[model samples]
Target: MDIEFLKTSILEFVQNHKSYAPFVLGLMTFAESLAFVSLLLPTMTILIAVGFVLAAADIPFWQAWAGAVCGAFLGNWLSYEIGQRYKKTAYELWPLSRNPKLIARGEAFFQRFGPWAVFLGRFFGPIRAVIALIAGIFLMPQVLFQAANLASASVWAFIILAPGAGLAHYVLW
Candidate 1:
C-alpha cells in the first residue's frame, strides 16, 4: 500500500475508534522514542496526523497527550537503562552498529551539552532517539536524567500534538 492509503486508513481507524486513539498514539510515541526502534519506525508523522484526527473526531486531547508523554518517558527510560547496563556494547548492536555516525553524533551531543542534552535533545529528531542512551553510557546521574526526561517528555508531547490539535479545534469547532 501507498503511504497515502496508510495515512487515510490510520486516520479512519482513529476516527472510528476514538477511545483507542490515545493508546495507539502512546505506542507510536514509544516506538518513536525508542533507540534502535525509532530509526525503523517512522511514527512521528503518523503521530502528528493522529493529533489532528483526535481533535477532528472530538477525542479528549488531554488523554492522548498524557499517553504520549508517558510512552515517551518510558521509552527513553528503557533506553537509558539499556545503555547503563550494556555501555559501549550498545553501539555494537545491529542498526546502531550500522549507523556509526548517529552514535558519534549522539555521543558528541551528550558530551558537549552534558545533562542539558537530555532535555534539549528531545526537541531534535535524530538526537531525540539516542540522547538517552548516550546519557546512560556516560553514567549520568539517574536523578538528573529522570528530571530532564520527565520535563522534556511532557513538553515534547505538547509541542508535537498541540499544533494539529489546535488547528483542528479552530477549524472544526
Candidate 2:
C-alpha cells in the first residue's frame, strides 16, 4: 500500500481499538529500529499518525511512548548482538552485505564521533542501524553504548511521536 493509505489505516486502527495501540506502537518501533528491516519499513509516517489517533481516541501518551522506547531499545540491542557475534560476516550477508557503503559510512561516522554517534545516529534513519552495528563491531564499551542507546532511543521516540501527540492533543482538546 501507499504511504497515505498505510497512515490512514493505522490511524483508523489506533482510534477504533485502543487496547491494541500499544502493540501496534511496539511493532512499528521495532520495525523502524531493527537493522535491515529499518531500511525498508515506512513506519515514521504511520507512527506519527498513531500519535494523532491516541489523542483522538484518548489513549495515554505515556503508554505509546513507553512501547516505542522499549521496542527501539530491544531492536538495536539485537542488532548490536548480531554485530558482536557475526563481526564482518554479518555485514557480508544480505542487506548490509549487499550494501557495503552502509558499513563504511557507519564506520567513518563512528570513527569521527566516537560514542556520540550512537546518540546522534538515532535521529538519522539511514544510519541508525549501521551506527549501532558499527558500535558493536568496534567493541565499544557496553556501558557507554547502553547509556547512549537508552538516551538516544528516548529522544528518538519522543522526536518521532511527539509532534503527532501534540497536534492531536491540541486538536482534540
Candidate 3:
C-alpha cells in the first residue's frame, strides 16, 4: 500500500501483460491532460517509465505514441467542454479550486496570445490543462480551439514519449 510499492507493482503488472501497454499509455496520457487529475498524477514520471517498458518489451514506438496522442486529445477536449459548460464555475472545482492564481495566469496567457495560447500551452507543465479550460471559459471559437489542440497534442506527445522509447530501443537493441 505504500506509494513506492504500489508504483512498482503497477509497473510489474503492466510489464507482464504486454497487450495492455497501449491502455496503460493512454491512461497515463489522459491523466496528464485531465484538469484536476493532472495535479495528482505523476504523468511525466510514469510516461518515461512506460517508454522504457515499451522499448524493452518491443512494443512499437508508433503504437505507444498513438495511444498517448489519442488520450491527450480526448482529455484536453473534455477539459475544454467543462470550461465551456461551467464557465467560471470550473474555478471552484477541486483541483482548480485551490489554484485561483493559476486560472488567472491562464486567462492572462490566453488574452496575450489568443488561440495560439492553446497550442503553446501544450508544452508548459502546469499550463496545459489550465489553458484548455481557460479557452473554453473565454468562449474561444470551437474550430480554432480544436485545431490548435490537435496540433499541439501531437507534437507534445512525440516530444515527451519518443525520446525515452527511442533511446532505449537504440541502446538495448
Candidate 4:
C-alpha cells in the first residue's frame, strides 16, 4: 500500500528470484519511462534498490542494463507513437490535462532542446514522462528521436542503477 512497503516488496522479490533481476529491472524501467504510467509508479526508487540487490547478489550488471535499455526504449517509443497518432488529443489526456504546468514545462523543454530533449529530459523527473510525447506532438524526425531515445535510455539506466551497484559493491567488500 505504502511506497516503502511496495519498494521493500519489489526488492524482496528481486532478492528471492535473483535470476529475474534483469526482467524486473526491465519492467520497472518500462513503467518509469512510460508517459502517463510514470506518474503512478515508484519505479525509480525500486530501480535503485534493485541495483543494490544485483551487486549484493553478484548478478552481472550488463544483463540488467540490457534489459533496462530495451524496456526504456520501447516505453518511450510507444509514448512517442501515441503523441504522434493522437496529436492535440494527447493534451486532453487525464494526467496531462490535470497538470497544465507540467505540460507547459514539457513543451518549453522540448522547444528549448529540440531532439535532444528526449535525451536530456530522461534525467529530469518532471519532464521525463512527457518530453517524448512532446517530441511526437511537434513531429520530431523518427531517426533522430530513436537515436536520442536509445542513447538516453542506455545512459539513463546506467545512471539510475550504477551508483547503488557501486555503493553496494563497496560496502559488501
List the global CA lDDT of all models: 0.88, 0.82, 0.84, 0.87
C-alpha RMSD values across all candidates: 3.0, 3.4, 3.7, 3.7
lDDT by residue (37-120, candidate 1, tens digit) is 998886887787667888877788899999999899999999999999999999999888898999989999998999899999
Error of 1 at 12 (Å): 6.3
* lDDT per residue (tens digit) for residues 92-137 in model 3: 8887888888888888999999999999998887887698888899
Worst 10 residues of 2 by lDDT: 6-15
Off by over 4 Å in 3: 1-16, 170-173
Residue pairs with colliding backbones in model 2 are: none
Supply the TM-score for candidate 3: 0.87
* Residue pair clashes in candidate 3: none
Off by over 4 Å in 1: 1-16, 171-173
The lDDT leader among the candidates is: 1
* Model 3: lDDT of residue 8: 60
